[model samples]
Target chain A: MAIDFKQDILAPVAADFAAMDKFINEGISSKVALVMSVSKHVVEAGGKRMRPIMCLLAAQACGENDLTQTQRLAAVIEMLHTATLVHDDVVDESNLRRGRPTANATWNNQTAVLVGDFLIARSFDLLVDLNNMTLLKEFSTGTCEIAEGEVLQLQAQHQPDTTEETYLSIIHGKTSRLFQLATEGAAILVGKPEYRQALQQYAGHFGNAFQIIDDILDYTSDAETLGKNIGDDLMEGKPTLPLISALSKTSGTDHEIIRKSIATGGLTELDDVIRIVQNSGALDYCRLRAQQETQLAIDALAILPESIARQGLYNLAMLALDRIQ
Target chain B: MAIDFKQDILAPVAADFAAMDKFINEGISSKVALVMSVSKHVVEAGGKRMRPIMCLLAAQACGENDLTQTQRLAAVIEMLHTATLVHDDVVDESNLRRGRPTANATWNNQTAVLVGDFLIARSFDLLVDLNNMTLLKEFSTGTCEIAEGEVLQLQAQHQPDTTEETYLSIIHGKTSRLFQLATEGAAILVGKPEYRQALQQYAGHFGNAFQIIDDILDYTSDAETLGKNIGDDLMEGKPTLPLISALSKTSGTDHEIIRKSIATGGLTELDDVIRIVQNSGALDYCRLRAQQETQLAIDALAILPESIARQGLYNLAMLALDRIQ
Candidate 1:
């Protein structure tokens, strides 16, 4: 049976999710009109809000009652996520995100950059209000790693020599680190130290699996299917996992094409590159890796008490895998 | 009295300033080569390190004996200031800062933006290590206002209707708030609650005066003297204090010219705008405002006991006013 995201994953924290959404709107409130409008635009453009949902579920799985502070944490997680996306759009020079005009697109790079800075500052301000030293440290360190990951990705751009280890480091920083912060932060807030490691492990593997699947789709899916154009990564010469794996498996002309495509990012030989990636068993290896990661993510949740929220956490991991399947 | 910066302002805290400079280099260390290099570049491009100097002096004036953690706080203040400058360069598309190529110019906007982000996160990470909730709250809130102030300035760009009130609000966020954080944060960290208000008042008014002087220089000074071009603000159509005051004090073509120049940023009417700004008594009004702010800054230091550090703060304010005199 196919899993339904709304029924199996978000259902456990539906009310809290609603409350968290409200808090996000409140959290981004600013006296500056442009800041408010840009923040509102990007926040409204948000999809699924999976990170905050994971935070809420982690709080519930820890068996916490009365989640007033938990809702705020959820909101902060989402705001941080939104802030990154806004900056990412400016970096990518993207005009459309989730079928809507991005903040950079609507205003300009200056507005996007400054508003993104405001969101980041506001997120920390709200986190400080939570008054947890450990949580603050975790988030502060996590954000640094996230930024390093982004710069590493930029460094790897057009360098086909980037290895899988480097790729893992990049994905871990850019994607999984925040996921760890989300669930692990909830554990810290709820005063459940024992559950922190498990949730972190769950979210870490889940984030890796999710990003790998995203990269794989860049080779396989189209703009209509994923809301992200196929070959987007290739066009940027980003040596993602599939391309890296394809380099390892292929030889001679096949390898040269992939290498050259990465060194000089564009879609000139996109069809040939995609065909090579598919034929060289690179996509198969990526699928296997994604499955393993998803399994590890689900297995990590075993330490948490059995509850609907825990089930929801398990289902969210599986749902991510379902996208590639 | 020439108010030599080296002799009067920096002498009292010169040793601690050295320690803080070392701390700044160590603080920017990163596992990622690109992040480290970009951060190092911008930090090296920094000017006289005024903000951190103010922080160190504030610590000494508060009667703090041990300067260990105070040095780290000073480093954090400088890092935060550098981070803002990095982002500002990107926002303004500036090629040089203090005659050194900017991060965006040396690398790219993507690198500059991401590295700027890394610096911000690193600053917060270091701040979290200090384990002071009140200080963290102050910085977290202050950074938000700083970003909002930047966005407000961007909104006022090409907008001639901007008032003196709005211009003050802009400068407060863009320039003075960090100054407040530098001094006020030192007071918070030193456990000198009594001095926090006085230090904040001094830094806030000093910041206002310092920025007003810088704006005045934009009309009067050139690259050879200030490392900033004349009419740079007018070139960007920024309705800064001089331009705002000129508009308030002029009429007919003189007023119309200033209004049109602000409405559309460029250097076509540069000479006319400067003449009106000078002849309309705008520079004198700006000079008077800067002096008043400087006086307020010095007056705020009266609450602190008579110490060399207090005198150093007084001299720093006086030195700023000397630029206009």
Candidate 2:
């Protein structure tokens, strides 16, 4: 499904996406070459490029196929997303990302941080160039929500009694906000308010499912496919949905072991923790919940006219659920 | 002169400025209380509150007396400036600020960074509330420039070959951009375009003088008065204007010691390094240059009508220069 969607939908826009990459690379000036280099390094390192592609595809779906604004906005969203990742690596203290050393690990924390600031600044500069006040305001608000989400996550970390509502709020702030903004910004730029709202709802639910699956994958996927070591979230003491839900369901020794591991934030005996989660049916439960969200995300698109882009988005949501299992 | 100015002008607005503080404190929401608390702790630690005051005075100096927008813009500038300080503390890894434990040292780098981000986000949110796109664009651009400047400074650190032009650019980026923005934003809000340009010039030149004196003070001032250790810049290997000028002028053994000390970034033999800078006449040269810039700043205010606020601005610029000495 993923292969077919990528070949048919993402292929035509691949060159435009490449052009957006080139635009960002050229955007960082020579005066801050070091920061630009570090920023470019992290950006150029392969990711799914899912957010930018969604942005461009959303624009295409809206029928305002002006590739200029579409491409620029695509680059802007991607850069903003990448900036958050660079800072996240520092906050998480994770050494590896996307199968390679994180920028913070490669360069010291200081450089990583300043470079993150540079990318964020660059994102704003690009947005300002678009001269759309509404778009600027929305993007700026999105950035703020993203920051608040990160702070929420920081507050949530290592706390065993975190509630599901709080967990959802954190995911909404951290993941869904940007996804919603990416599609919504595209729709706004193309003057499709109804479609923009629909796309926003689509992206928001899709993002929630995507992040849940990501957290679940941390438990079920091994080091190779997951890029970094498995149980990293546990090591970081991130009480993700699966673990939180699993903890709520379990009792006695199972609960105590999970609580102790979260408190210590060390996974020397990873197999034991994984066994508890799997045996408790938390992984299956998480997959089921993710599937539900994916369905809702697809449902949000019911108002929009059916197009290849809309289908691709639906496939993307399904792919997120499928990848987790 | 400083005593009289502070007693008369600053003391009166001290009440109005105190109101601005309430606005800032109220701006942080309960949802992100932890992050906001950390931000407020640093902001309220009793730095002079000079920047916001400058914003208020600049607006008043233009002969417009609606204090509402001026007060809000002042708070916005102060929040933006405070955010940079929080991030700067993380970048510098400094432990003490304003006679208290630095936020980064007390809370941890993650909190410092995210809290700083929160403040920045809040600054924009406030700007959006003002519904002035001109101020928002100007302020946002100023922020991006400030980040770029800091990135340049990070790269320039430990490099002895940094030019005077580069040094000026860095200081302008780090200090003057926001200084200019504070005054200019106020003027724009108050509907005084001519005064806005003049105030921007005044603030820009004043900021340069202020920063130059600050660097000089880092070399010559005592720890008790400065609230920071002398040679803190040297320890950080920051090639401030004084050090850069001294490096260019000195030759033979003195030049080698200065270069090596900057390269290594320490004050193990403090007296010796001070002696090199003193013998090179770098400290005196920097003071003379700062005085010249302060005069230039005062001169830039010539277009404004003769008013107490204008006099207050003049007094503040003089106070900045005198405080360094």
Candidate 3:
């Protein structure tokens, strides 16, 4: 059966989701005009509010009904996501994301960078208001890893020697660590210390699955379907899973072509690279890896009680996988 | 009484400063090679470690000689300062700072941006370990103001008619807020709540004086003296105090020239603008304002007890004022 985002995945936490969504606006209401406008644009432009929903769902799955702190955590999660997106646009020099113009595109890099800093600081400010040192430490350390992951990606750019292990490290830091923070932080806030490891594992595997699916889409999906042009990673010389796997699968000229394509990023060798990546079974390997991660994520959820919220989280993971299928 | 930095300012808390400096290295120690290298280069390139010194001195002035927690706070202040400088170099597109290559110049903007992020997160992570929620809230809110001040500076850039009041607000955010954080945070960390107001006032006024002197030197000091080119602010069309004061002091062509210089950023009319500013009593006005701020900063220290550390902070304020004279 097809999963609906609102009815299936977000149903158990729908009220909490709506409340958390309002907090994002309150979190971003700044005295500075440019901050308010730019933050509004980027936060409003955010797609589906996925990460915050994950935070809310995870909170409920832990059987903590008090939605007050959980809602704030959800909002903080979104603010952190928005901050990274602002900086990512500046780093990528991107004009648009998911159909809307990015913060950097709308207000230049200087404004975007500073506002991103503001969002990060404000998120911490709100987190401090929660009066939980453990949660603050978790988020602060999580953010550092997220940033390191991004730099590691930059460090690996145009380098063909990057291993799958390095790629996993990159994806985990840039992508999964925040997911871990969202779920694990909720458990921390709820005082369910026992659930911390399980939630972190669930979010970790889920984030890996999500990112792998994204990497897969970079090679397989069309612009209309993905809201991003295919070969976008290639243009940036991002040695994502497909290119990395393709290089590993091929040999001689095919290997050299893949290596060259990863090293000198552009779409000049677009057709040949795509053909080689597809014909060489690189996509198949990626799909298999993604499926394994999804299974691990689903298994991690078993540690939580069988509740509607747990089912919602499971559905969310499955829905992310459905995008590829 | 010509002030010597080591004797007059750093002497009282020199040992704590040394210990705190170690924390900076420890804090920035990451497995990511690029993060470590870029962070080390920028931290090594730091100027005087003034902020951390203020934190240590403030802790000492509060009569809390327990250097354990204070040392960590001082290091956190410096890490935060270094983080801002890294991003500031990117924002200004500056290749050099303090006669050394900037992080953006040494690495790339992407690396600098991400590493700056890592520093911010690391600083917060360390702050969380201090386990003081009040201190955490102060810093979290303080950083938000800092970022806003930066954005306000960007928003006011290239636009003339920026009022002196607006310029003061800008300086307060960009310069004074962090200074306030450095000293005020020390008091909070040391459990001297009453001294928070006094230390905050001293640091705030001192920061204003410091920034005013720095801005004055932007027009008056040469690359040889200040390691920065004269008219650097004008090149960016920054409506700093000298420009703001010059506009108020002039009329007719002289006024129009200052306005045009600010409106259209460049050095075409740099000499004329500088001549008009110096000859129009703008420099004297700025110098007078700097002196007044320095006096105010010193007066704020009366609430604190007579201590060697307080004397050092007082001497540091005076030395900053001496830069203009």
lDDT agreement with native, every candidate: 0.94, 0.82, 0.92
Query: DockQ score of candidate 3?
Result: 0.88
Model 2 per-residue lDDT at A49: 85
Better of 1 and 2 by DockQ: 1
Q: How do the residues A1-325 of candidate 1 rate in per-residue lDDT, one tens digit apiece?
A: 8889899999988888898878898888998999998999999999999999899999999999778899999999999999999888888888998789999989999999999999999999999999999999999999999999999999999999999999999999989999999999999999999999999999999999999999999999878878888999999999999999999999999999999999999999999999999999999999999999999999999999999999999998998888888
- Write model 1 residue lDDT over B1-325, tens digit each, in one string: 6999999999989989998878898879999999988999999888999999999999999998787899999999999999999999999999988888989999999898988888999999999999999999999999999999999999999998999999999999999999999999999999999999999899999999999999999999989889988988988999999999999999999999999999988999999988999999999999999999998999999999999999999999998888888
| Residue A15 CA displacement from its true place in model 2, Å | 4.8
For candidate 3, the TM-score is 0.99
Per-residue lDDT of A1-325 in model 3, one digit per residue for the tens?
Answer: 8999999988888888888877888889888899899999999999888898899889899999887889999999999999998999999999989988998888788888889999999999989998998999899999999999998999999999899999999999989999999999999999998999999999999999999999999988999989999999999999999988998899999999889988999999989989998999999999999999999999999889999989989999999999989
C-alpha lDDT of residue A253 in model 1: 100
- TM-score of chain A in every predicted structure: 0.99, 0.96, 0.99
Docking class of 2: medium
TM-score of 2: 0.96
Off by over 4 Å in 1: none
Model 3, which residues run further than 4 Å from truth? none
